[model samples]
Target chain A: MLVVSLIAFVMFRFVGDPVDQMVGLETTLEERAKLREQLGLNDPLPVQFWNFVSKAAQGDLGISYQFKRPVAVLLSERLPATLELSFVSALFALLAGIPMGVYTALRRESFLSKLFLTVSLIGISLPTFLIGILLIFIFSVNLQWLPSFGRGQVVDLGWWTTGFLTVSGLKALILPSITLGLFQMTLIMRLVRSEMLEVLRTDYIKFARARGLKDRAIHFGHALKNTLIPVITITGLQLGSIIAFAIITETVFQWPGMGLLFLQAVQNVDIPIMSAYLLLIAFLFVAINLIVDLLYVVVDPRIRIGGAEA
Target chain B: MSDALLSVRDLVVEFPTRKGILTAVDSVSFDIGRGEVLGVVGESGAGKSMTGSAIIGLIEPPGHIAGGSIELAGERIDNLPLEAMRKVRGKRIGMVFQDPLTSLNPLYTIAEQLIETIRTHLKLSERDARERAIGLLDEVGIPAASRRIDDYPHQFSGGMRQRVVIALALCAEPELVIADEPTTALDVSVQSQIIDVLKNMCAEHGSSVMLITHDMGVIAEAADRVAVMYAGRLAEIGPVRDVIQDARHPYTKGLMGSIPTLMHDSDRLTQIPGSMPRLTDIPPGCAFSPRCPKAFDRCFSVQPACERHEDREVACLLYDEGGRP
Candidate 1:
């Protein structure tokens, strides 16, 4: 977290000052000095960093220059939007990707399997921004089936708010989620297929067959369970990337999420918001990796024993 | 012949390689009668394991039973559909592979694996299956069978794990058990214990066994009848004592000659000159002709057929009626 914060600090520090972004070019020099002094921008770099760190540790991320609100408040309001999108998209990716991969691996020589492989290749190769635009063109402009952009009206339930249950909201979510999830789906599918192939060739699988186990039991029960160890690791890592790096999809769809907020903050030179976003993303990656490690103990007994020994 | 429990006739298993077809088991024929133990002994790469795999329909892809038939209790099973073959495999014909580590699934408990097989082949309640699993475990000489039944494969020692595997194979009370080098991966001290357990369990259950191994001592101690293989072909087969005392085929003689004996003090053990021929480069006539010390002109020109001698079957020109040279 410190390294990430320092990197973000150094990057934004080298860029032109936020004062120039906040005020007009014709502003008087005295007014500029007054504003710089008020914001503690006149302090030395080390003092400035120390101030930022102390404020961040206390959950006071300062005010966003662009939004004119506390960075913490803006993040809390937008966090649910990003979480909802990520949860739905990740659920879709895993539900569809793993089974498709298993089917393809089993029927590797079939034409349908070949087609799925080709489609997954294209999904991984194409950029998410292009996929978003293409989806909007087909579903919004050409077919008039779904909304083109913007997160639809949300229903606040005190603890959590979601656009997913509403009709217009669900329609609005389809294109952007698909655009965001395409790469993850393809990544998961390819990983599952390769892992399943290797697991199917293992000695235990062969012995399972010799034991006269039903093909379904051997494939899904034995082989798929073994394959899931690696797949879960990849899925957890990808989930972090999906939530942190949905910038392009969020921008194209005008989704009210952290990615869009971060983009607008960068444009308006909102250093506090950008730095907070960087630190949050780094924290998220570390947390997700820790979760993946714990999940290994649940899925595999051998790993559980090893962990117990440690 | 009618009482034979498992009869494998002219079994030919082949692998389609980049360089034409490689016949791994070349027209190998053998039988195990009711409550009989047939030991198949050969050097490495002599297709001993392939023959066992073929009988159970577990030969891996690109390697298949190209020709021949396997009959279990007079019903042909070689050409059965995959589903039907599966029914026959664990229920009628059990298999114990060489490596105990590989044979058992590491994640599941011994009881789970055992009960699954027992319930699948036998119509028993889960409770009944659990009882049967424990019973089989106890029968296989596993100490504290009830408690150890719930333990995972990794928790057991190597010999104990192999015993668990033996219990698993006999869970359904299969009529025929194909044990392919079951003791190969064990310590020398544990090898005889496992073999003794296997022999006693099979005898108690009255199941015919086809024991595939390269260990001559195991065959002499455990098998009633013995089959010797050379380059995928059966060289000689007879009562274990007769074959050990007076091996008819030259390859069998070479095998017997190589066993070090305490009865005779020999500075060096007798060994066959050359190794078994690879499938791709097997000579047109006898596969053992190049290695046989008594190779004659006819042995190089004509492939000898397995013919009955005084008391055993021998596949060599010397055993032929008029062609003896």
Candidate 2:
């Protein structure tokens, strides 16, 4: 987290000037110098980085250059939108991906299996922004069944506002979440299909058949259980990527999420928000990886023994 | 034949490839009487394992039983539907694979696997199934069967896992157990112990065994009758003593010669002249004619049908009624 914060601080520190973005043209040179001094811009690089790190540790992300508000407060307000979208997307990917993967693997030559494969291929190849626009055009422009932009109507509950309580808020989440989740769904499906295919050919599966296990038992109980070991790791890592890269989906839909805030921060040279986003993303990646490692022990006994030994 | 618990006739297993159809097991026949141990001895690719797989209806797709009739306890099983065949598989005839390391599902506890198999074939409650699983594990010589029943396959040693496999195969008290090279993957020290466990457990369950292996020593020790295969065909079969002491077919004679005997002071063990013929290039007449030391004109021109000899059956022209005419 510290390294991520440091890199984000160093890289964004050079992009335009926070002072220039914050000041007016009528301001005199003495006033500008006084403003820089007040903002502690005259401090050495190490001292500036140290201040950023120490303040971040204490949950104070300094202040946004553009909003002139606390970065943490801005993030907390926007965090729910991105998180809700990502959670729904992840749930869709896993719930749909695993069964589709198993079906494609088991009945690979069937017509429906071929269709799923083709659609998944398209899902993987198409970019998120293009998908988002296409969905918006179809659902919002032509059908007018769903709203195209903005988080519809959010409900505030003890500082954690959610669109879930409001019908419009739920409807508004549909397109952006699908656009963001399609690639991951396809990825997970393809991964599960390959893994299930390999597991089916293993000796244990053959032995399971010899033991007269029902197809359902052998396929899901034995094969799918084994396939999930690797899938869990990939899904966890993809979840981290989903939150960090929701920027394009958020942009196309104009959802009031952190991705939109970060984009605006980037345009206005808001270094504090930029650094905070990076640090948060890096922290999420590390935390998700830790969870993935824990899941390994739960799914595979061989790993449980290894973990115990370690 | 009437006493035979399982009988296979003219069984042919074939795999069709882009090149052509490859006959994995061609017109093979054998029988395992109730409570009998029939050892199938052959080199790799001799269709010994394929024959067992065909009997259990577990041949992989595109490779299937092309022409065959299998009967268990006087009922025809070769024509059974897939679901019916599945019921026959673990209920009437159980199978033990070669590599115990890869045979059991590594993710499940032994108790889970055993109980599942037990409940699938028999109408047992969960508590009854667990008790049966533990009992079978104990019968297969797994010490601390009750305590170790919950352990996953990986937690057990290779030999111990084979013992668990045996326990699983016999949990429903199958009438026949087709153990394909059950001891092949174990250490030499563990091999005999595993064979002993398999034999004792089968005996106690009153289940016949079709033990397939290339090791003649294993056959000599475990089998009541022995069937020697050469290139997907049964070359000879009889009581283990007669076949080992006086092998009738030249291929069987060659196979017996290759066994390392402590009594023989020969400098080198006798090896068959060539490897078993591949499925694509089997000779027109006898598959072993090219390697047979006693091949005559008829042996090259016509395939020999199995003929009854003094005490056993031999598939060679030399054993014909006219005696090599």
Best by DockQ: 2
Task: State in Å the error of residue B87, model 1.
Answer: 0.8
DockQ, candidate no. 2: 0.86
Error of 1 at B53 (Å): 1.0
Q: Identify the leading candidate in terms of TM-score.
A: 2
Q: What is the Å distance of residue A101 in model 1 from its true position? A: 0.8
Model 1 over residues B36-114: C-alpha lDDT tens digits?
A: 9999999899999999999999999989999989999999999999999998888888888888987788878898888
Evaluated against the true structure, the overall lDDT of model 2 is 0.91
All candidates' chain B TM-scores are: 0.98, 0.98
Taking the tens digit of each residue's C-alpha lDDT, what string does model 1 give over A1-310? 8888788777657677878877888999999999999989888999988887788778888777776789998888888888888888888889889988999999999998999899999999998999999999998999999998887878888767789778888878888888888899989999999999998888778877777778888888788988999999999999999999888889999998999999998887788789888888888899999999999889878777766778
TM per candidate: 0.96, 0.98
Tens-digit lDDT track of model 2 for A1-310: 7778879888657877788888888989899999899988899999998888888889998888888999999999999999999988998899889999999999999999999999999999999999999999999999999999988998999878898889999899888889999999999999999999999999999999998889899998999999998899999999999999999999999998999999999888788899899988898899999989988888888889866877
Candidate 1: count of backbone clashes, pairs at least 3 residues apart or interchain: 0
Which runs in model 2 stand beyond 4 Å of their true positions?
Answer: B323-325
